[model samples]
Target: MKIRCRSAVFAAMMLLLVLAPGVSRAGYDYVDISNPFLRKIPIAVPQFKSFSGTPEEMKRARSSSQLLAETLAFTGYFKILDPASFLFDPQKDGIVAPRINFKNWTTVGAELLITGGLVQTAGLVEMELRLYDTFKEKLLLGKRYKGALADQRRIIRRFCSEVIYKLTGHRGIFGSKIAFVSTTSGNKEIYTCDFDGYRPHKFTNNRSINLTPMWSSDGKWIAYTSYAKGNPDLYIKNVREKRGTVVARKGINISPCWVPGRFELSATLSFTGDQEIYLLTGRGKIIKKLTNNRGIDVSASWSPDGKKMAFVSKRSGTPQIYIKDIVTGRVRRLTYEGKHNTQPNWSPKGDRIAYTAIADGEINIRVIGVDGNGLIQLTEGQGDNESPSWSPDGSLIVFSTNREGPSRLYVMTSYGTDQRRLLEMPGEQSEPNWSPNIEGP
Candidate 1:
């Protein structure tokens, strides 16, 4: 979809006045904000002020600020300015309000500035963060967070989410997590880590092959296909409690996809001699059969509203993406350009669907509109890239690629920019699933 740009002259003038409380004049035009081809904002983040007396407390404060700056830069929305060339010292120029020297920031070519202070009280820590628009000299947002000393990462992520909300009217996905199948332990197991690829935790250790991990909408459970009992069966793992249960089906149980807002799921089962989609509850009771095609049907992804679904099927000559209407039992082909198109993941915004396409002898990532128009290729000129999954906000995509030798995970913007390696592990990794925004640590 295309969006019109606003007048540049008017946007420049809006930066000169003091914006109202809780209102932002950050010069972001929502009409064109969805366009991924725009330039990123330039932001400056100086060291946070420490109000503690001990050296250990001061060191913790500095590290906390650096973590926040790294998180913002990883979003691909802001270019962090180096502190060595800063014209003004945050300690001397002040951290908030009238004490800030807006001219000093503007002289350094920074459009936005972030300032904060950290202090230790008793056994806990308190932090205050603020975002400022340098040209207009306006405070875009201000908030305070209090928690234990070990909760600094969570606190900073919450504040960064607020800054994104003020600028783009949408919450950021910094606090989210990603789940994928990893062979780091010499076997394929389900593992999860933070969105920035830190602190990886193993979810399944059955010593057998596990594939296709899918998170529930509420972020409480993960459903995947495992071979723990010597059969290809579906199992759901409680994320918090670290417990697992088998779905207990007849044959070839795989590709489980949870409905948007309920405890039900749609998965592929081969009990009837052919792979087909079936709706089931969280506890493993079958609700109804979704597809009865003669060819193989698998990998079902639901739309945002839960009324429609996209899946891979071989009803035609080769495997391709197909869309099905739940209400009327109507099916239509959704991909035609490529001979092999699979792993279709509907975006959270319900505008586009991302999948894997085989072109020029390589598996590349591609996206197509809901109506099967505006097809765009995202990855090319390297090894295979497959299993595309969208972030909660539909602004980013995470997939696995073998372009760098061993298969490893990667993340990029929706428009295929800022593509970078996500994590470094020993063995091959694939089938990444981005989780929803988790509420707490």
Candidate 2:
């Protein structure tokens, strides 16, 4: 009997190995780059040159160049170069001989290169962009646009989308903003700003800590946690509004997340003495209880279909993420390799859940499949990267990292690449909520 049991276990392990390449791997890292199938290659980006434009127009070009570099870098395949690291200046034809030496560029470890410049034409400014294949010594993309000096942001963003297509076969999300919480001001407050930390707006004025901020389907309203009235309370505020409404009851109203496919919310409320995940209607009424008692069930994340939920609980002693069906109340454990796990945020397409797994009490976010497979850790050696929110397109994830000092915003791909600091506001911020791509006001 014992031999048969061991044989069955070995067979199961072999089957899992064949099904999930990264699951049960020895080491945990942001990406499982073991099964390399000609994954996207890296590229080098240099700042674009600007000439014959207004002082303000020149500044806009420079800023647009930075944003464009950032957008390509976010795609996870580009090994972006720092503009300061470039020994060669970015100049156009007649300015730097117009002939780029491919050998010089390829020697610098650049597989692909991008070049562009902005010039003043009439009362408007003209932006010209060119992407090159250093190996082929040919231009991959070339385009020019004419727009007002102040339209630099949109024009450059269009140019960036072209860059991403030239490399990753897709467009990039560069003009998006993430709403989250910050505690650097001695207390946590709700804030929403640009993806690159340009224009920040404070949402909550109370001197209390906030957590679990979730963006509305429309990307305008922000639902979050506040202790303003004592005990954790769930409050929803419009990004542009004169007031906010209490969505849930007081006392342990933790981790409210937006429910996909509908205007409802799924949250963990502990009013019954122990935490349990609940599905609340859009109007703040309890539609159903998703979990029973016996454990501290929290951190409920809804799949894109809103049919299933992923959450963490103390049912396994420490904490482990669990998935449950909203219809039949059937439950399943989603993590076994990690001893400590929490905060499971479902992917936009519902393929995986990104959660925090504590290694010796230090927390780092990791990703896993919906059926407790493909456990891939996304951060290595960190202060904390607790809550991870996926972009509407499932291409990017914005989370908080304390590795580099105070907790600030960081954005990376679903496969984890090109990690970059996203915000440096006046206060500590975390629990990022990446909204859907809604048209700006």
- The candidate that wins on lDDT is 1
Q: What do the candidate models score in CA lDDT, each in turn?
A: 0.84, 0.69
The RMSD of every model to the true structure, in order and in angstroms, is 8.3, 14.1
Off by over 4 Å in 1: 1-21, 24-31
Inter-residue clash pairs, candidate 2:
182-428, 182-429, 183-428, 184-428
Query: TM-scores across all candidates?
Result: 0.92, 0.78
